[model samples]
Target: MMKWACHRPLALVLGMAGLAFGAPGAEATESGASLYLLGSGGPGTAVMPPLEGLYFDKMVWVYDGSAEANRRIPVNGNITLGLDTTIVADFTTLLAVPSTNFLGGTLAVGVTMPLGAPIIDAEGLLTGPAGGTTLTGSLHDSALTTGDPVVLTQLGWQADKLHIQLSTMTNVPIGHYRESGLANLSLHRWAVDGSLALSWHDPESGWDISAKAGYTANGDNRDSGYDSGDEIHIEGAIEKALSPKFSLGIQGYYQKQVSDDRGMLGPFRGEVVAVGATAATTVMMAGVPATFRGRIMEEIDTTNRLEGTSFWLDFTVPIHMNMPAG
Candidate 1:
């Protein structure tokens, strides 16, 4: 069953009993909307890592890069699309607002933009009526390159050793997309998501853990006449601080369709699970504090979705990290 996944697209023409029929469920997986589910639990997940109340008067810049690869993805009974050129490079900028009356917390405003795509290669085996075929090819298509831009707004509350937040992410559909394209980076529809996140810290041992859960409400793709499904995603991480400037941890995420995919074909579901390790460190440049984080993840299980590995490097630098201490 080829579900139009980012990792698989049965482009081959397979037949049963002399009847030519492409694979079933040849729908496009939620590549455009699925990017939001990559979050992993870690410190300050409940809020922008460096844009919390205590960090007021500061702005942060973040860069993320990731790639996914899958071998022999089934497209149909006789065809397959191999995925190799999957990569996403994203940039985000965030600013922290001072304390507010609501939840006695702070507000964070940010914008995240991604420049990349999902499908990179394709190989196929076409079975004809004569039952003889050997086929192969490669493709490089980046879904993220045409995907919409995301806006983030969240309220964060920090108390002693506890941190909590409520956030919303909105994706604007105004990127490159073709209704019939084998692979695309744009959803061509709006997606609004809400999330709750939490972080706990132990001052003495410098141990910490965090988690974030979110739900997505998607809109219809006018061009394709298809409505992607609502989705649920969870991200979490465990970490230990080696020093005030360094930390190491494990992080991961899981995502699944909550509502059946709507439109044209009507209602199909998809799911995926992934896990990875994380490492981070802080450096001072010209009296400014900067943070660098790197993570690698492996997709363990998936249904009607992409199956592959992913990794990213994140760098954050606060604009006012050089400000004088009180």
Candidate 2:
């Protein structure tokens, strides 16, 4: 018989994973539709001493194929010959600041390098002239590139229910734009995202509730004929612990368009509904504590303009600061 060690499920760990794969739709533009905050401020709310730490997050995205259409011309232009695959790498460094009174807040900023490639490798699809033959492979090939920087200011409030946090972030357009590849689809822009969440301690209740909302406003992507300026997103989640070291969480989100540059496109109204689940556990390496997490999400395409449906899978691992002295 094999012996198994039991571990207690932490609501904070499961909530953080829920936010990871919540929705890739147009949220508060932290990093092209993804949230910026890395981990939860559950127990790690204290202002740490100035020291260097390495934090990394990788997102592997594989998009389903769809047909490209022109609204005005009323024609199915071409099949999206390749998938839109994105791999983002973020390297984070934490800096400690002075704590005000009993509440502690930290200013941690990081830079992200987004790399992607269109699965279409064939060339010479759309070369020239009106209609340009194949609009699928006309543009340049997708490759690695640096895309905008994200700065995070997290405010941790020592509350009664749970440690509360208010994080503000910004996104700058410093990337390229390709017609058919991983290039950015929007122009230079900036946004602010805010979230309010709590981790409960009631073992009998066995459930946690968290709600977060975000807003975004910026320039337009005229070259691609898609206007993206004003947007709003609101989300709510319910999480429950199934057992020690394992749990399940569900989340739903809504996006509303505030304004429209519309550029040269058709109906600009867009909204998305997302449902997600997550699982987490602890993995000890060399006597050090590290948390491993996984999430699966499905998004409904309420708006007919964009892709009808999409799915995502993400993993997060949190590194404990208490390492053995060398």
Candidate 3:
């Protein structure tokens, strides 16, 4: 079946820059609750589920679709963030370092750059200090945000029936940010993420199951005066290979805010659960290897977080395997 150098595209959504408040079911705030989950890699993404660890190079792509509204907290009316008019993409390359093997395992590192074409539609009541309220029309703000780059490092070990990996992904705060705006692409904060995954594969039987979980620690946004909360996410999948080149499976994710938002927001928590389907395949191109994976997710349960559908397409092409050693 096809093998994927698992990577989460949600990490590329930039930081929680503008568009603070989440939908009704979602946690709305000016802190880290908007989205991005502090750049923590989501489930089915923190680790690769291959029977053998890959020591080659690869390039990846990703996309997300969603929309939400927030109103309960502010009586009159709330702000809504529609992602249908927003487009976010990530481009990354994973490279295997020469002699990166430890004992019998392999080590790899990758970097990701993100681009965003955002359409943030915001409208609600604005209350001034004089207790006067002004109703503003819906704002359809658009901006192209160049997101901060992400660095990912992984250590993987594989056996006959099981594979395990440890990973760390860090988000650098180098994207665009505006303290005042309907929406922004950059979170304007630093984040360090970690994950571990284990997978069991039986090639002869065409059965595979894998699970991964991750945690995130975030830095405070100076301009926004907000300290986003820490978060934990988990993902897992079960599948069967129909042929040497194809596989189909079920995948799901669960995320929760572990700590409370500080500095500018109260102690609030948000959580979400989603389940989806996935298909994977491998094809040869001009004697080169490429893999394609497609997935669709629907949120089943959510609190303080938006409930929406997300879809993604991943393409990985190996560039170079290894360098000559002295």
**Which is the leading candidate under TM-score?**
3
The reply for model 2, stretches above 4 Å from the true place, is: 1-111, 118-142, 176-188, 194-206, 221-227, 308-326
lDDT of 1 by residue, 198-230 (tens): 878664676777888888787876665456678
For each candidate, the alpha-carbon lDDT, in order, equals: 0.51, 0.36, 0.54
Off by over 4 Å in 3: 1-21, 25-85, 125-135, 263-265, 323-326
Per residue, candidate 3 scores C-alpha lDDT tens digits across 1-326 of: 13443322222222333232344522433322333432223323423423332333222322243445343222112223332234344444454443345666766666656565555544543433322245565566667776566676777777777778787767788877755564455666788877787777666777777777777787777775556678887777787878877878888878777887654225557677788887767788656556666777777776665455555566665555442455
Candidate 2 per-residue lDDT, tens place, 1-326, comes to 00011111111211101111111212111112332322222222222212223333344434332323221111111222222223333222222223333344333334434443322222223322343453544333444444445454545553544434455555555555444443332223444445454334333555555655555554544344334445566665555657655556666666555664333223344455555665545455555333444444455653422232333333333332323389
Could you tell me the TM-score of candidate 1?
0.73
Comparing 2 and 3 by lDDT, which wins?
3
Candidate RMSDs in order = 10.9, 8.2, 5.2
TM agreement with the true structure for every prediction:
0.73, 0.61, 0.78
Order of models, best TM-score first? 3, 1, 2
Q: How many backbone clashes can be found in candidate 3?
A: 8
Ranking by lDDT: 3, 1, 2
